[model samples]
Target chain A: MKTRQRILHYTGEVVLILFLVIFLIPLIQTFFTALKPDIEIYKTPVHIFPQHFSNVHYLHVFTRLSKDFISFFKNSVVITTVSVFLILGLGSLAAFSLARIDFVGKGFIIFFISLILSIPLIITVIPIFMMETAMGIKNSNLGLILPYTAVYLPIPLFIIYNNFLKVPTELEESAYMDGANRLQIFTKIFLPLIQGGLIAAAIITFLNCWGEFLFALILNTKRSATTLPIGIMMINDEEQSWALGPMSAVMILSIILPMSLYMIFQKNFVKGLMEGSVKG
Target chain B: MKSLKQGKKIRDNIVGWLFVLPAFVFLFSFMIYPISRTFILSFQKFNFVYDSKPVFVGLSNYVEALKTPSYLTALKNTLRFTLWYIPVIIVLGFLFGYIITLPKLFSSKLAKIVLFVPMVIPISMSCYMFLFILNPQWGLVNSFLANTIHLPMLVRDWMNDPRYALKIIIVVTVWQRIGFISLLFMSGIQGISSSIMEAAIIDGASAARRMWSIVLPNLKETFQIVGILAIITSIKLFAQVVAMTGALGPNSAGGPANSTLTLYVATWKAAFINFDMGVGSAMGYLMSLIIFLLFGLNFMLTKSERA
Candidate 1:
């Protein structure tokens, strides 16, 4: 029986390691493919590992598709960075207000957001698209940014609220007694206290904005306004023969910024992510 | 003091709204406003190809969408894929999370990073990866079956068959999303204490027994969270499909007898490719209604279960 239990434990470990390898292979394939030259991509039974890789594709992507690639990269970076900042800044205050301040309609507002957050995003898609087209901003960066914020709002706010609820009411009362106004109290005391939660929220919001696909695709058809995902997809969609290498390069390019940003803050990434997931 | 407090409260409210103003305006403009317009636009007939004036046509657009055979087909495919995708993502993801929690076995951190990487990559990229792997022309899998499996015909065009195409679409999309759901389940699982499981184990139960009897019962919260995210993300399974199909859309019957055409892709083609914004908007509205009905019961079930 003791030997049987040890065998089960060993079996579990081996299965997990194999599963881990399966998970990492795509990331590995990405880099391996990125390093390979264009000539190798079309070779039958395409080289899983190029015998000799050149940086030519990367340079080609940089120099040839540079203008289009960089612009889309810039667009994605700007939207993600700005939207993340807004989600954290706004999500913090609103969560605080929602959590601490007892006011009329607070329960309804909380309930509404909770309900809205739970539903699959299809509910608002039609309304948002119609609204954007009517306002004549359907194809602009504003179009992508707006929807991304709304979609990401609930999770961050939930994070902040959860963290806030854990703090004792005395913290707020102490600040009040110190003659600090409510805004100052919130900005100075509560905000700083929830810094870990805020970092988690900001990192998550940024990731969401960075990865957003649907709105970015539909709202920005024009090349100049294109975000990275659309740019990569659009290039492949153009039916160019040498589409694979350049498209892969673009795919790598678009995801690198977000991926690196994620890697840097990966610890917070899981924490923020896991919190958001269980709530909804 | 009372008046002073009132004035201070007013100021706080002002500052608070000011902070939240950007997010509110952004959501209002893009989310709230566009949704409102789509509701109204679904009633208007617009010739997208000719760029004609959109005339308000009441329920006629909805009626038109309902009459179309493809609308039903896309709806059927969407539900089928959702059904296929959600159950596996939720169940396997939960199981993986449960296994990782067993005695802290060999560090879940590395496992999580590797697992969730696909969730972050461009959908187009993963689409390409799967496309290459499943390609019939000396593709990796085809080559494998030809040599090892010893049947050249068994290396079928995975993406070209109607019956197989939808399943491939469902599988590909589910693969991209499973990592994130698993990570989520892990986090939620972590929040659950091991004492309950310890009690069960001490009671002489097997791990599966512990999982079913104690772990799973405690994991209801995680289940709810993963359930919602899975169903929700599965709705926008478009860019990847379009990438796979070469974007001819309904123009070429969406390939393999149009079996892979999702509601989003169909609606997109209706507006842009077919150039019928009326039908497109109608497609969007109808799709939303269908998603609501299918997921609504699950949502309410989870909600009521929580209460």
Candidate 2:
């Protein structure tokens, strides 16, 4: 019985390790390929490790695609930042009202917002394209920011609303007794209590806007306004045909921001996902 | 006194309105308006370029969309993709969930972090990474299989071939998504009372029997959530197809022989590439109808279970 138990434990460890390796192979391969020179990319029997490492690909991306690359990065940063802030500010306020305040038409409104969340972005892209173009913000960063904030509003709103509900109403009533106005109570008491939900909402919104491609692809056709994902897609199309090295480098660069963001806030992000799923 | 009371009531309503006004404004403009416009456009022959009057054609667009071969193929491919995606992801997810939960694994948390790393990277990056690794010539996957394993039979051009194109996309999608599914399952597993497991063990039930009779049944909610979410995400699949194929595949959207064209991609081509807004709007409505039905079904199931 002891031998059987030991065998099972060892076998499980081996299987887990093997699975991990298989899971990470693409990322590992890309890192190696990103370090190789253009000529070595197509070398026979694929050198998993490059014989001679090259920083030339990274240099080329920074130098040659510098304008497009920087613009893409800047656009992604500004759009994601603005969208996240808007969603949080508006979502929290709305959630405070929905969860705490007595109001008419609240049930219908919440149901409507949930419906908005359910609709696919693809369905909304065309009309948004037309509306933004008509309003003359289509090619601007604000164009993408507006739609992203709206589309991602429901999730954060839902999360924060639940967060507010979990906060004790007695606390708010006591704050009122202490002469704290509604705004003061909201900012001082409720916001502090729901900081976890706020962080989760912020991270999810930022990531969603950061990774957003379809809207950015369709709405922002100008090279200067394109976000990182769109830039990666465009560069991949143009460079993959003749130059795989630079493309790999840009791809690697594009992945760093989101990866670090996730790593830094891994716990909150996972908490957000779990909470969102439970609501679903 | 009556006027004072009415005024106070009105003030309360105003305060409530002020709180929710900002989010509602954005939601109304972007979400509600676009959806209504799309519905309206579905009934008209509105092209952004050549149309002058925005002529109303009344269901012809829907008929045309249904008749189009690409749209039909996309619909079929979506169903096919979902069919292959849901079951594989659920089973693999539960397996990983079980593995990491093992007490003997010293670094289970580290293993989980590694599994979830891919989730942070955008689909575009992951898809392109797979494209490089899965390249037929000089690709890591082919090289490993052909040389190290000495099994050339298993090596083939995965993304370009008609038979394997959709399957390959499914593989990458599942790979990126498995971590989330596993996490969901892990949460579900943690919800299970350990006392129940101890009771089963004391009753001398084998590990496999305990899992089959106790664990699997207890995970019914996780299975439902994972399945529904997987189906919904798969239905919206676009970035992976575009990045993986570079829009150079057959039909300029899906992979070779149009084997990977999904409804989302098809709608994109219609609206942007062909400038056929009417057809695109029609397809979007049809797709949403299907998704709505799925949500309805899921709601019914959950409600019934609760009852």
Candidate 3:
């Protein structure tokens, strides 16, 4: 029986390793592909290993892709950073109100927001594009940020709402008993309690805004205002046939921040996703 | 004193509304307003560039979507993708979730991180990675199949082929997203109390029996969430399609004979590419209707289960 258990355990380990390798191969390929010289990229028999390493692709990504590549990166950083903070701030306030404060039309507000959230981006982009263009905000960071904040508001709002609901009422009640006003109580007590949810919401919102392509593509037609995904797409479109190294390098650069952010705040991301999933 | 109390009551309501006002303002402007406009546009022959004065077309746009062969093919493709994609996602999600959680799997942390790398990498990049690897003649997978595996018959251009284009896209889509779903399922599985499992074991329940009777039932809500998300994500598959097949495919947006054209891509082509706003808005409404019904069904199912 002991031997059988050991065998079963060994089999589990083997299966785990096998699956890991299968999954990691593509990522490993991307890493190696980014390193390979143009000569090696298209070579016959598909060399997985680079015969000679070169940084030409990396150089080209910085120098040759576009004069506004850095601007694209900057735009993405600025847009994502602004949108995430707005979502968190607004979402938390709304969530706090809905969760803790008994107010008129709460159900209607929640239901309406849910309905609004369900309207997919494809359906709404036309009007958003036109509105932004009409308002003269199109091709600007504000064009993307406002719509992103709106699009992402519901998810974080709901996540934070659930977080607030789960907070022990005693914490807030004590604050109230100690002569705290509603605003003070919210800021001083409730905010501190739901820090995890806030972090999770921030990370998720940042990731969403970072990866957002369609609206960013449509709204920001100018190269300077575009985000990383759009920049990457432009690169892909320009050099569809080859330029694998530079393309892969740009791709790698675009994701490094988000990937590191994910790794760092992964626990919050998971907690937020799990909570959002369950509630949603 | 009563008047002062009334003032405080009004103040409370004001504070409440003030707190929620920002999100509500944004939601109303971007989401509600645009959706309402899209709905209105669907009924009118409205092309911003062409139509000087938009004329009411009634259901003509919907009629166009129904009648147009490309739209129908897109409809079919979207449905087929969802049908094929969701099960694989669910199964893989569970399998990976379960495997990673096994205590016997040495260095599970590294394995988990490997599984998660795909999720963190943007879809555009991942598609490019797969594009290189799945290349027909000189790609990694094809070469491996021909030389290492000795299976020359299976070798083919995956993305360009009409038959395999959508399927390969599905594979790539699943590969990128499965990590996220797996983590979700892992959490759900862990949420299932170990004490319940112990009770099942004490009752002489076999592992399979325990999984079926205890674990499966407990995972119903997770299944619902994961299933709905999978459906929504599948429907939203546009960028990957663009990344895999360049914008200028044979039929445009859907690659070689429009085999890979999805509803979202079709809608984008209509509005943006074709500059036919009315038809595009109509397609958008139709897509929204399908998504609404799917979400509604999910909601109703959960409601019924609770009842």
Candidate 4:
């Protein structure tokens, strides 16, 4: 019986290692291909390493596609950064009020947030596109920014609300007694207390906005407004193709942003992501 | 005293409104208004760039949408796609996550990094990466298969063939998503106390027995999270399909024969391509209703647990 168990364990570990390799090879290969010269991209019996390793792809994108690249990159960065900023700023206040303040029908309002967050925005794309077109933001960055912020609002709001609820209101009450204004109390105490939750919320908000594709694809048709993902896809087809090298290089950098952000707050990001999922 | 209390309540209400006002403006402008107008447009069959005004006809647009073979195909394809996708993502994520947590090895950390790399790369990046990798000629997949396994181009023109296009979408989606889901599961597994596993081991129970009886049960809560993510991600499945097979799948409306176009993608064309806002709106609403019920049940059940 012990021998049989040992055999099973060895088999499982072996299989697991094989599966992990299979899963990661494509990604690793893509990174390797990024260093290959553009012309060598489709070479058969593909070389695992680039024959003539080139930084040209990286340099080309930075130098040649600089304006378009920088603008689109900025579009993603500014929208993601600011939306998260406002979402946290407003979300914390709103979450605080809901968690602490006595109000009529608080349960229903909180319930609404839950419902809103769960409903996938895919069903509402038609209406959203129409609204954007009408607002003259159909192919504009604002169109992308506005809806992305609204649709994702429930998440940060929910996190902040739940985290706030866990904080002992006794502290806030004590602050109230000590003559700290509500603003002062929030800025100095509550803000510092929920910093982890806030960071997690911000990271998620940023990732969602940055990785957003569908809305960007539909709303931002012009080169000026399109995101890196959409831009990459558009350049994928046809001659003068951005080539596999630069494409993958840009993709690698794009990935680094979210990867680093996620790593910076891995625990909080994961915890916050799973917040609404696990409790039930 | 009554007036003062009412005034303070009003002030709080104002503050509340102010707080949500930014999100509200976005919701009203983008969601409510567009949805309402789109719903109205669906009732009117407007030809794109040709018809100035859509003629108001009730339910005809839906009838038209349903009658089209492509619509039926899209429904079937999406169902089939989900059937293939959900299981792989769920099983692979859970299985790989379990293995990754085994007594830390020399390469476990490096494996984790590589496993997660695919996730951070945007869907567009994956789409392009896979395109080069999966190309029928001189593509990495075919070459690797030919040289290593010697399969003699088991797949050629994958995107152009209806049969294979869906597979490509499913494969890419699974690959792109598996990493993230696995990482999520790894964390879920970590949340379980090791003492229980250690306890089971000390008692001389087999690893399989312990996993089936103990670890699986503890991971149920996390499984629920994965379940919701899977369902939500499944319905909104767009980028992978669009990126892989082009505008609508290559052969058909979704293509290789309407094989890759999902409900969301279909709704997209109906609005943007066909300019039939009403039908698109109705489709969107129908989709939302369907997804809402699914998500709502899960949400309520989760909430009820809280109660």
Candidate 5:
């Protein structure tokens, strides 16, 4: 029986390793293709490994292919940063109230947030586009920022609210006994305890804002405000589509921040997602 | 003394509303207002191309969408995609979830991270990578088939081929999402009581029997959640189709005979490309209605099961 258990364990390990390798093939291929010389990229029976590696694609992507690439990257950074900040601030405040404070209509507010969560973005984008146009906010960073904050708020709110529930009520009571107001208690006591939750919420919000394509595409048609994903899509224009190496280079560049965030704060990301999923 | 207590309760109510006010304002402006506006727009005749003012048209847009072949095809394709996508994700999610949680697997952490890598990367970037890997002339699949395996006859342009385009889009989306779904399942499996599992093991149940009798039954709520999420996501399939098929141009998103056209893509094309706001809003409204019904139905079924 011991031997049989050992055999089962070994088999599970082998299957897992094999699946991991197969799963990473696309990502590996993207990296390899990005490094290969342009001529090799066009060669038949595409090489999985670059015979002669080159940095030309990276250079071209940053310098020649898309002159506005830096601006796009900057837009992505600024927009994602600002959106995450707003989401965390507003989400935590609301979450704190819902979780701790007893008020009339509290249950209705929770129900309303969940209901809004169910409304998919595709249904809402057209009117948003029109509204942005009418208000002359189209082709600006604020246009995407406002909608993104609204759309992505529910998940973080719930995650933070759950986090708030886990904090001991004694902390709040003690703070109140010390003559601390509600605001002071929130900032001084509860906030420190829920740091992990805040990080989780922040990471999820950052990833969503960074990767959002549709809103960025429709709202920011101008080069001045286009984010990374839309900028990458723009590389598919008639002239640049054939430049596979440069395109792959651009793809790699776009994913670096998200990949690193996932690598470092993986546990927080998983926690946030699992919490949201169970509630969902 | 009672009046002071009452005053404190009123203050608490005021504070609670103040805290929620900012988020409420944003949700109201972006979500509630836009949704109502779309509903109203669906019933009007507004075409940007004609430079015409909005005119109230009663249900004509919805009637025309039902009659339109392309819109109908888009709806059919979305349903078909959802039918194919949900089961594959569920089965694979369970398999991977179970495997990664196996005892003494030192590589479980590595496996989980690798599996979840795709979820963090943007969907459009992944779709573009698949686009390159499936290119007919120099793509990995065709090249490997033709030159390495000598199966040249089997090679074809995948994304542009009507017979295979939708299937390719499904494959790409599944690849992007499988990791996320698997991780969700993994958490569900982990949430199962260890004592129960140990008891089954002591009872001499084989691995397959343990999984079938114990794990599967315990994962009911997880299944419901995953199913609802999968259905909603599949219905909102826009990015994959757009990024994969729109390589030529934005207008070609649902191309090669529109075999891959989804409701979202069709709505996008109608409003943005054809400048037909009424038709697009109508399609969007219908799609949302379907989504809400499915979501509500899933909840009802789960509630009944619990009872």
Candidate 6:
């Protein structure tokens, strides 16, 4: 019986290790391929490890590739930062109001948020495209940023709202009695208390805006306004689908920020995901 | 005193409205207005490139969508993708979830982190990575099979083959998502009461038996959540198809004989590519209708459990 239990435990460990290796193969392959000299990319019996490492692809992406590549990176950063800031600001305020305040039409507002959550974003793309084009904001970063803030609002809003609900009412009441107005209490007391929730919302919003493809694809046809994902697609086109090395470099570049954020704030991400899903 | 309290109430109302007004303004413009317009547009004939004005054509767009072969194919392909995607994701998710949560496993933390790496990266990056691995000429899979394993006959052009194209897309989507789903399931497993599991262990139940009789029954809510999410994800399948299959032509996504064309991709092609907004709008509503129906079905099935 003891041996049987031991056997099961060892087997499980082996399976897990094997699965992890298999799971990470694509990512590992992409990293290796990115570093491989251009000539080795097309070599037969594709080597998992690069024969000779080359920084040419990386250099090409950064220097030799058209000025558009740098702009794509910059555009992704600016758009994601601005949109996430908007989401956190508007989301936290609305969440605070819905969670803490007694007001008319509160139930209606809650229902409205949930309704928007259920509707998929694809349904709105066409109209948004037409609207943005008519408004002359199409092919611009602002076009994507505004819609992203609006569409991605409900999830973070719910997360932050639930966070506000978790804060003790006594804290707010005491602050109120101590001469803090609503804004003062909110900014000073509530914000610090639910810092975890706010960070979680920020990380989630950042991830969404960073990787967003559909709207970026449809709305931003101009090279200057394109985000990373669209830029990668454009790279595929510019390379005429043959230059895997530079494409892999761009892929690595696109993932670096999100990957680093995930490594650092992984706990918040899990917390945010679970909270959003459980409540949503 | 009454007047003062009433004044405070009014102030609170004003404050709350002020707080909510900014978010509502964005949501109304971007979400609500577009949804309502899409509804109206579904009932009209408009083409961005060809038409000067939208002519009212009530019910015809919807009727025509039901009749069009390509639209029907897209609908069929979406359902097919969903059918394949949901079960595989759920089952693998459960298995990985169960394995990662085992108390005796020393590497559980590492496993959890590694499994979730795919979730954090951009979907397009993953899809493109798979494209490199599955590229016909120099792709890793083919070269490895033919050169390393000497399985020359087994190598095929994966992305362009009609028979394999959709399946490969499913594989890529599953790869991107399975980690996240597993984590969700892991959370669900952890949510189960520890005492019940301890009792089963003391009673000398086998691990498989314990899992079946205890953990499985306790994971009902997780299954429902994961199921609905799978359905929704499968329905919104766009990026994977676009990235994996590559574009067949200008503004077209589903390719290699339309085998991988999904409703979402088809809608994009129609509205944006083909400049046929009417059919696209109707298809969008139809997609929403399918989602609502599925949600209703899920609710009904779970109603008894809740009660």
**Candidate 4 C-alpha lDDT tens digits along A176-215:** 8999866677678887898888887888788777877778
lDDT ranking of the models: 6, 5, 2, 3, 4, 1
RMSD of each: 3.3, 2.3, 2.3, 3.8, 1.8, 1.7
Clashes of each: 6, 0, 0, 12, 0, 0
Cand. 5 TM to true fold: 0.96
Candidate 3 chain B: worst-modelled 10 consecutive residues by lDDT: B244-253
- Candidate 3: where are CA atoms >4 Å away? A240-242, B1-9, B247-251
Candidate 1: clashing residue pairs, number:
6
lDDT of 2 by residue, B1-307 (tens): 9999888678767877899999889988888888999999999998888876568999999999999998889999999999999899989999888766766696576677887888888777788888888889978889888988899999999888989988989998988888889888888998899999999999999999999999999999889878888888888888888877754531466868778899989988888888789999999999899889999999899999899
Q: What stretches of model 1 exceed 4 Å from their correct place?
A: A1-8, A115-139, A237-241, B1-19, B47-56, B147-151, B191-193, B247-254, B294-307
lDDT of candidate 5 over B104-166, digit per residue (tens): 787787788888888888888888888888888888889989999998899998877899999
lDDT (tens digit, per residue) of candidate 6 on B97-181:
8777877797777788898788888888888888889889989899988999898999999987899999988888888888778
lDDT (Cα, 0-100) at B159 in candidate 5 = 79
Per-residue lDDT tens digits for candidate 6, residues A13-42, read: 888898898888888889988899978998
Name the weakest run of 10 consecutive residues (lDDT summed) in model 5 chain A: A234-243
User: Model 4 over residues B1-307: C-alpha lDDT tens digits?
Assistant: 9999998788766655555555556556655665566667768877655777778898888888888776677777777877887788889899778767766453455556666556566776677777767768757777877776788758577777877888887888888777678877888788889899799899999978998998889888778778777876777777777777673322333665677888877877776677667677666666666677877797799899889
Please give the ranking of all candidate structures by TM-score, highest first, separated by commas: 6, 5, 2, 3, 1, 4
Better of 2 and 6 by TM-score: 6
lDDT of 1 at A104: 52
lDDT of each: 0.72, 0.85, 0.82, 0.73, 0.86, 0.87
For each candidate in turn, the TM-score is 0.88, 0.95, 0.94, 0.87, 0.96, 0.97
> Residue A231 error for model 3, in Å?
1.7
By DockQ, is 2 or 6 better?
Answer: 6
TM-score of chain A of each: 0.90, 0.94, 0.94, 0.87, 0.94, 0.96
